[model samples]
Target: MRRRAIPLLVAAVALAAAALTAPAATADEGAAPAATATDAAAPAAGADDRHRPRLYTPAANPEAYSQALDLARAGLYRDAAGILAMVRTPQAVWFGDQSPAEVEREARQVVRDAAGATVVFSLYNVPGRDCSGYSGGGANTTAEYQAWIDAVARGIGRSEAIVILETDSLALIPSDCGQDDAQGTKTAARYAEVNYAIDRLEPLKGTKVYLDTGHAAWHGPASITPRLVKGGIAKATGFFTNVSNYQTDSANSWFGKLVSACVAYVGEGGDAAQCPHQSWPREQADAWIAANVRTPSYQWKHFVTDSSRNGQGPWVPPPGKYTDPQDWCNPPNRGLGARPTLNTGDPLHDARLWIKISGESDGLCLRGTPGPEDPERGMVDPKAGDWFREQALELVRLANPPILPGS
Candidate 1:
């Protein structure tokens, strides 16, 4: 039997058709203008993942390693949509090497390369790019944030884009900054912010949104579920776990299962026999949920991932270090994992995306330039990411038969 399709019950959404490319495009699903960096609405923005050591993305196309994207398209079914970030604090500015023009060109190339398939993209520069502050952060007001979202909307509005919205905003948005640590106000406001975001985003067509639920360690079923509800999961596609950080796929699965259970339970009433809209009866509820708890089809088709640098899973904590080990910063021994793609099995899970690209280091590593001295490299490792690209190509090729160069 065919697996169930993820039904994105968005409260509000929006879509854009194509860049001046309407003439070159055909009907797929989404509507909007061609997504260009400039097209991406401003503020509204923001946005790791898991360890499978799976040789997936680059393995599909050896050519990406040796050929131009145009030439490599034949063999590679998909490619990654690396981090597309922006800042709106002092003013609007993008945060990647490729110029806005280059970013737009490559993004469109991805659209063309995929043929009719979907390309999963992550828009991570939401005002507060790094919730922790420091890099690519902003938007003190909701209106400012919405303006940013409008910009992102303009960027991908035109395609059948599967977007993973802010990674852990649902679990983090704080309400009042004035209070001396009022968790209640902070969480309450996050709910409102996310809900408003969904309303703004739903306007776009064919866009599947996944809210951020931090790595498994950060939350539990009861905790995340409430946040998800507040974030408007009822209207969203669903919530995504493990973005930017690292947890094994097995660990992520366990976490995902618990959250899914909570979602079912939340929607289910206590009196199973009298539960309204009861799809699975009380007796079968347990078994049914177990059987239906959305196992990620090996299809890995429905999801998107950042094969940017995960060849090796997260930084294993050194023997004794808990306080900012700096593993998140560009560390040694890291290789690229899966590339970004649009085939996620669960509709709620837009795509296993490379929201965080490797080229852009998280910050300084344990050994590298320790702070203050060299501020130029906030989190960029030009030399490091280049080496991983080769590894990425190898992995992508392994997953999909190597694409013959120039084919």
Candidate 2:
């Protein structure tokens, strides 16, 4: 069976041929001349009025924007506005497929575009990323990865950046996918590589680095806490969950708290096995935390959650479906989640981010069958990182909190 494909940097393409086309691009996604910053219309005028001062809107994809413009020319104003709403909003800028010098230049360009505002970078170039699965092709060796990190750090020198270090790096490793040796040499290198990244990037004057902890549904606190420790959460900002997966915000918050508490407990001479997990009854878990963890909230590690595509929550695949449901792979009918923000009320929760680009595809999902068509949708899905018009429309149409005001 194939592994899940997480979002990463890729050249955006125009929509594939299909009729009954969804929304067209807004002004931001239109054939507007390419620039350092986004030209798309925001919810309101001015940064302060539209959202917090921290949000950094990046440039939109020309091809996706042009497709939206065509829809608008045909009187698809509603659809065009919806597509515009997605690209204009502040989301992470992915960096992985570039050479070290190229990445440094691009990273520096983003910093200049932010203009003193905070920006999110989903850094996904860890060696053997996605277990050489759908989104493979990272650096060939650990040394190469270190050089890449060095360039990224230099690019962002003295600029505000929220670094979402390597998605699925800690959660999914070589050992988990049968890609490691008997002595687990590759797995050990993976840990060291993550630690090296933390050591290099965390020290930057204006950078805050968060490690990956997968999502709430996949790894509970007890299981992921130790991995976070092994991956160097002690010297980092914290961990991020639900990067390219759909899990409700409430669930992600609760899971984050459990992991934070477990990390504190283990740091203070407690065993990871005894820490409460997500599966424990709420009352029982609360009581356990009350009795054991005495660390102040501020001192404990903080976390962030991805709200980009959790608007409708996770899809429930039909019973007796395919042998492997592949629920995370472009599941049908998912909507956009909450908009990205820096003011999450919970101290332990850092921000609700659109870590995954909302409109991009999650690869050609096979669902463990021979045919190329996805049985559920009756169409072959787009390759990962491509502009998935059908899925993009579904997201806009079903977005939670409504992508447009008064919609």
Candidate 3:
């Protein structure tokens, strides 16, 4: 599912106005966002890659920038600066539900905005997306989806772009969500659709397409590896995890390494079931990788992780509070995670991204309750892709790296 906002001009104008009214820097304020001590000290995973692309920061959501102005007017300069800093950070621009012509035009405009920097694109609108859940709705047919993807490719022309092919397309297939037929027609179509997308987008000289592998918490590396292979991982740059989910960076990185190793092992005639998963002891898993997986780091499938809202890690529900906790849906107290960076300092890991637009609602979360209001928050959450002001404020206040410099 993808979050959206009002038209581009309105958001641009609102963000500009808010930027003008934001308080001038004080002695305590720093010029740019300051990385936490933990981040500054973390080992470089892929520091050898001296040519990693620069990331592009797209325009902010209208409501979010407007909220910054509102806070500034209310004499909360720290919060206002935090919000401004957050929106100014680099993030993805999603494309979906638009006609091929519309998408092509919009994609071209985004490339133009980026100039020469690399832009991250979250392409939703796959048919049967979300299995008709809260953020459902996609192209009506397979042909329509192919046409849409083709348009996106044409829009990029030859510019640099990292296409996060489709979130949840592999992790939660039609069969997993019970949306498949007895003969599995929809599931097969889903694979073909993903393959088609990879074939279409990955060939562009300036484009690198990545498949979806859910998150570290959902599917184990061994379980998702076979699916990635079937979905044409051999053709894609690699796969991404933790899109729109709250999982720790360490967890995601380990999961990615395991999955890459498993893919290589399976490719070398080993069974995916026999590979080490995230649950295995780290010492044992590392030992296994050393002994069995012989693929070079450059040859192995690289991965990107979403760090938009995992600053506080994941939320824990009170002991057996609800039948379906829906922990993934709008869990409270989640803060913003690491800032997007290509120089992640890991060989297997590519980058840490903010794939899910921070501050957007994750639909109406009931948490298995019967009330119209969310039991945890005492009010109904906004619709799936709408702006969530309360959650936005919470994210800025609790941001792990600390959105403000000295806060």
Model 2 lDDT per residue over 121-164, tens place: 99999999999988887999999999999999999998988999
Residue 60, model 2, lDDT: 68
Please report, as a residue range, the 10-residue window in candidate 3 with the lowest summed lDDT. 29-38
Better of 1 and 3 by lDDT: 3
Question: Please, what is the whole-model Cα lDDT of each candidate in the order they appear?
Answer: 0.43, 0.81, 0.82
- Residues 95-166, candidate 3, lDDT per residue (tens digit)? 988999999999998888776767889999999999889989999999999999999998988998889988
lDDT tens digits, residues 1-407, model 1? 11221111010010111111122111111112233121111122231112211111111222222222321233222322110010000011122234345555655555454333344555454433345443434456556566556555555555555556765566555432232154465455556667776776656675666677776656766666766766787776666776666554545545665565666556553222221222234456456555644444332212233333454566665655335655555445554444333334444344444455433334424333454422222333433223334333333333211111121
User: Candidate 3 has which clashing residue pairs, if any?
Assistant: 44-345, 45-345, 45-346, 45-347, 46-345, 46-346
Ranking by lDDT: 3, 2, 1
lDDT of 1: 0.43
Better of 1 and 2 by lDDT: 2
Give TM per candidate.
Answer: 0.54, 0.88, 0.89
Off by over 4 Å in 1: 1-117, 125-129, 175-187, 269-308, 339-350, 366-407
